[model samples]
Target chain A: MILVNENTRVVVQGITGREGGFHAERCMAYGTQIVAGVTPGRGGTLWQDKVPVFDTMEQAVRETGANCSLIFVPAPFATDAILEAVDAGIGVIACITEGIPVQESVKVYSYLKDKRVHLIGPNCPGLISPGARCKVGIMPGDIHRPGTIGVVSRSGTLTYEAVAQLTEAGLGQSTCVGIGGDPVTGTDFVDILKLFNKDPDTEGVVLIGEIGGAKEQEAARYIKRSFKKPVVALVVGATAPPGKRMGHAGAIITGVSGRAEEKIRALREAGATIVPSPGEIGVTMKRALRR
Target chain B: MKIHEHQAKAIFARYGIPVPEGGVASTPQEAREIAQRLGGRVVVKAQVHAGGRGRAGGIKVVDSPEAAQQAAVALLGKHLVTHQTGPEGVPVSKVLVEQVVPVERELYLAIVVDGSGKAPVIIGSEAGGMDIEEVAAIHPEKILQVRVDPIIGFQPYMGRDLAYAMHLPSAVVRNAATIIGNLHRVFIDEDATLAEINPLVLTPDGKLLALDGKLNLDDDAFFRHPTHQQLQDPEQEDPLEVEAGKYDISYVKLDGDVGCMVNGAGLAMATLDVINAAHAQPANFLDIGGGGDEAKVAQAFRLVVADPKVKRVFINVFGGILRCDVAARGIVQAYGELKTPMPIVVRMRGTNAEEGRQILNDSGIPVRLVADLKEAIAQLQQVGRR
Candidate 1:
């Protein structure tokens, strides 16, 4: 069941920082084969949880055969950190930092050509494959159980909401990935959906999304084009006036075209049984199962 | 951050953009003195956060200095209701005392984000001093839009064309072009999302002057301009919503009894709508944002519970990217701290959902695990006596 298993060791970039240290400790606790932690000048030392530290991604990957890199570097340094991970031959790169400059994420994404690597997020919460026990983002460790529902979202908190609901509905997850909040994200929704589609264990899907980006529309198109399982969607920003910025800062979807109505219309048109409230996710999934 | 017209003018003047002489005062005596100093009939305008001050009697033409003082006295500390400032009304914090200009021709000019394009766009009209929304909806023909090229910057030809559209006198056209050019520079340089000049006027004497100015800077851009921080007018804003922004939670208080909690803004709003669709009212819309640690989630629960208006509770989150288990831990942690004595319906789904449910089930918290979004609403509906 492990497509990329324990041998694909992880190197934690910015291992000295708050998010990095916290998640690094959690991932190690979850039994991820963590090879090394990367924090410049913190090399030759050990993380509080006793993971060996290295000065750079190159050194860590070179020395320990760490092919998967999880970056918790702050915004300004995130660009360089992801690139270093990619350049260091990391097969999978998860940048778990929010507020990464959009332009920087784009440049890094654009530069990823010819490299057979998967980039998850520059603003995402990272991914978790249950029972494997490795967590590379801020998602808590207590709620996961190895089950069949595959989860993907443009939101971090909403992802938790859907997961909780699915578990209560007696559905478990194969993998949960936070695609992040940035407008220009590293992975498209379809990319993760495809992964779930291929996983035999993932029977159904719960996709939590918000208004603004064309990402949901693209997901809708992908669903209509290929996906067969009953997909439940929770699209946020209803009654939220389009084009006015909020706490996500400048994220606003305005006018007749980008409003919640249009996105919901597309989602519904694509055969997604839309769950109006995140609170109803469990109930809705139960209903979906019965159908 | 929003500053008054006079303050905006002061800021604009520093950037070498020509503005008509104006002074702000909180007292009647100060208004009279400013009017006398200007040596002309004055415009007494209430300093509030809304438009339509001219039609609402908030703005008055005072022929004499004494009349200016009387008008200032009447306007000071008074609440001026306008369409933009909402029902609570914008409080008259001060009075703008300015020389009355004789207008031969008027033009409207503004720079705001094109909500459709997600770009800063310049809007200009031959008709000045009008409600922009009305102008946009009605006489859109008069409104000339110029897209500021992010790369090459605002072209000189765009300014010249916009100036020509205003049909200013030859001497004033050059001045108008300079103002438009400077406005573009100011907009990009300041990281402003909206910079408007209402009644950008041509006086009968053939001088071009900016009668009023308004600028709304990008909140994210405020980090770069520390000195330009302005106080939010609470009377013109939502207190709970404003307070929530400080805690990094996007919260909007609603008239519903079911207090709803979710992790994404879009999801939160959808939750509210679903609550409504089920004929249940949502008490509040709360998003815990992307940083979903136990503390942040705990705080989100705390905020939901804080609302006395809320009767039953609906907790929903989709941990598609967030681990379902982490969310469960956060829920258990918060439920432990408060004992959350209220009847709670929780629907958490996505990755690690099964494990997350096990964590919650083990927590011994008296929380209902709803089957989905609608059933949770239906359950909340049954419990709501309100």
Candidate 2:
């Protein structure tokens, strides 16, 4: 059911900008069928890799027939790029920009739900379906191999750390999605978990979560009811006592249900393997897979 | 970051907060000249960025200008240890020779961004010149907090209410109002993380003054106020951590085994906890935040590998915005350059991870990637474990 194929044409917003150009070049290097770039007032300009450029996403989609969009726009312009990509009917959009204000992320989140679109990270590293030969966002591509475990995280580096652990144990991944650290993300942990559960390539999954958000608990509940595949969960911010400790945007600790202990309890009750340390994530995933 | 006492007092003066008249001096001669001009018994205080200096011999009451000069000669360029600044002594860069005021009473007042409810709170107390933690533990009721409306900030009347609760006299209460107003102004204008006036003294003349001060500015907002940044004393900060910040990586030095490199602040903190639970202390918290370029990762790797305490390097990256392979290449490149014998425990997830692993494997580096969080942590716990 992974409908997107390797040849899915892609366009990058803010493509001439530093992050855009960097990732655009990386994606191009990985042979991700990149088609066009959209940067206002810089239309018809071309980056060195020679992807056709446009002033607007609509034009980029119209001219280049790009179905998927990689957005490397700055935080101040993230909402606009996401909205524009959605409006342009670019079926898939990945916003890799960090520090997008929470309010902007909320607005963009609301905008994405009404449309038939799959949006990844306003503060994420983007998504990669391995062995399919596609790269989007800032994630380093070379470490990945096609295998059973699929990763979905609210954190970029934590996800990378988790995936790296998996790969070290000779456990390859089917897909890994950093859902972004913002409170309001395009895809939630449960949503990505659902995707991984259905994907045949992903036999097991790892979810690296932080404090502050209730997404981890929600994901645990969803796994209890829906997921047939084994899941390994590691919740960060454990020793951080409640005096002034708060976690990520979606990290839901403090108001009773959001505590690390509570989340770990829920995950334990939900039949998912829980790893206390970040380093144990890989072994935990392999053990979960064996079970 | 924290600002020195003299700098804090200067900022207080700008906002109309009453601080003891003082001049900063880099040398004993300058201290003597300033004390002579003040023409009275003065307090020679080491201008380090720590509290509890009085207990650490960093503060001296000099009866004459000659005494002030002698005190400055002993303190300047020397390290002063305080209970608050940890065991490492704070380097005294400047001496603050201020006109001494007879204190009838001492009170505490501070405005800090309360991480709870995402609101700012004013913490004030009748008893001052003591650790706020000790105050909270013992006479918690004497403390007053008035949460401000984020839109309007602290109103003047609320400041008066807090002062009243602290049981100030009529004359001191009015001074408290102006001080609170000044504090609010400083908080809003400078985007301060914490601003405190400990021992806001009531003089023999029944006048109120901010006797001692501390201000912590938000680093993220530092770009807006370049001038206030001159107040930073790099001597108080860890050199490696400062170096890490240049690369945009958040590296906090801790005593532990594995050198952790993760993106995202929230995740990095959690990574430390896990290493601790595994009975291994994380040597450093290196958030090779977001960009994850070869240069940054290389710098981070060199730093961790250079540390003799770091028996293992646990790299747990979930490639969301960062690619595992790019990180792998960075590791490969950095390892080749550093040529370190330290064992590296590699665990990567999220987008293009295999290519990253391939790069690490191909580099002839014996980096091992783990498939689970607990196992990798366990591996990292035993640096030489196969």
Candidate 3:
């Protein structure tokens, strides 16, 4: 399991809110170890009549021995929630909350540099390990099946599209991670690719990227150097105009490096089979693995 | 969330950064009054969000107040087309009139978020007063960058290093460093993604003045800076896009015939790409977000069909937090409300997808449901052919 497994004790931040409660129930139904819930001033309460609720992360950690944090806090307080989780010694954090300011995200990124923690996203769908039955995000659990293909993407529904296609192609995913669509995210493609490369269960990897930033190029370089697995890549936003942010904050073509063609060329040169469109993600990955 | 040049200059001046004396004018009379007060050679610049105003005849320099009025009259309420703005261009409602400083040299300075680094980087160059992208492409080595750690923040020594790297004169190195520090402070304090001073000029008196200023605030950080949010001009944006924002939907208008409404940003862009691949242009990019209820989805649908160029609508939703049933109901409701004969195609999956498809199938609406992306593209192509 790259980020989560059956033994991972999860704490639900902002569990009392509507979105948090709803997703927590879904994750629990998927057989995840949702050990505790945290909402300020909601201590000693029972969430869904089973999970324990605490006012702070520290108390939740002390009582439940939670190792992972799934945050659904609002944008304004989401940064503080991540820091709280970090301080409480949570090993892994997946923030589902979107629209966190870049300044706050950068500060969190700086603070987490020395800490022994894995932060997934401030604006992402989160990650899931189908084989381990460990779902840690807002992704629909039923669509994922247990297998060896590892998928990492900078999108939410687009990751779902790829995962569903993979499952349909008889290539069940070991884990699917959405690093997020924000300009500054906690974890990136390279970090997740490294985990996927080392995991024994993950046979191959599929990287989904969009416009904006040189992150795909960085991942392409890493794949060429050390990754010893079949890789298939798909970069969207080929038709997107420059400078106009297409829904995602990070999906804008600012300069020459942020264009989709540049990223596609870099990935193609690095020996990864490039899928021409979103429709081809599954068959392309299967083909790359066979070769 | 880009602020006008005058607004950026105001913010810069508040931080004790030196900028040429300027005033914003919306009318020719106001321009004349401001120019008379400056009492010297002044430049009238269109206060649009785009760059390249100087090359597009949006900027005019005059020695007299009458000439300033004439320049304002020529620019005000007229569309100023530049390379940044498309053929239609943006209307110049206001102009900034400033006293022109005698320049000894021009330098570039800006603080922007380095996306990959996840930190703010201070970019400086000796070559300025032109497009920075051009300079970066032609002379890549001329661009100097210093990444500022958000934890320790921008240090004075880093500013000193940047000043020395720019090869500034000894007399103004300390002053340049101070301005850089102040600019960094402004970037952090204002929650700005970009705080730039292109053409930081050196006057004959050895004083550094920000000749042109541009500041882009982080839209996500607007909750903290409510005052900054008030600076947004709705007139400058597409009316439909502004309407979509009111319903918490992200919408960008495009010159395409097929309208796309998807749940996520990446999926929406991919939808556009696929539509284009099918030889059908997407009229707009619209995302109703993760948890779109019936009402929000209806609003999003209305926003998409509101575009006259949109002949058909395509809804591709891989529902997670947003249930397929809810989206289907919303689309059906919107179709009924609009009472238009526009064709609609949907590819719904994930949570409650079967129920959602059933709802759409029985809605008495003539909607085509496709099983996969390829099928959906084929349907879109057929619709375009009609």
Q: Number of the top candidate by lDDT?
A: 3
| Model 1, span A1-291: residue lDDT tens | 223344658899988887677778777787777789999888988788567899988889878888888888877678899888888889888887766544345457667745888888766767777756666666765567777777788766557666766777677777788877665666767878887778777788888777665677888999999998888887777655544453343245633445667777888999989885656787787788679
CAPRI docking class of candidate 1: incorrect
Candidate 2 chain B: 10-residue stretch with minimal lDDT: B112-121
lDDT of 2 by residue, B327-366 (tens): 7877887788765566888877667777888888788887
**Candidate that would win on TM-score:** 3
Give per-residue CA lDDT, model 3, range B1-386, as digits (tens): 88899999999999999999989999999999999999947999999989889899999999999999999999999999999886888889999999989999899999999988889999999998978999998988989999998988999988899899988988889999999999999999999989999999999999999999999999999999879988898877778988988888999888888998999999998898889888888999898887789999988999999898889989999988889999999998989977568888999988899999999999988789999888999998887778
- Using DockQ, give the best candidate's number: 3
Model 2 backbone overlap count: 72
C-alpha displacement of A254 in model 2, angstroms? Answer: 15
True contacts kept of each: 0.27, 0.35, 0.85
Interface Cα RMSD per model, in Å?
4.9, 5.9, 0.9
| Residue pairs whose backbone atoms clash in candidate 3 | none
Residue B105, model 3: lDDT of 88
By lDDT rank, best first, the candidates go 3, 2, 1
Candidate 1 residue lDDT tens string, B235-268: 5555666666677777766666888888766567
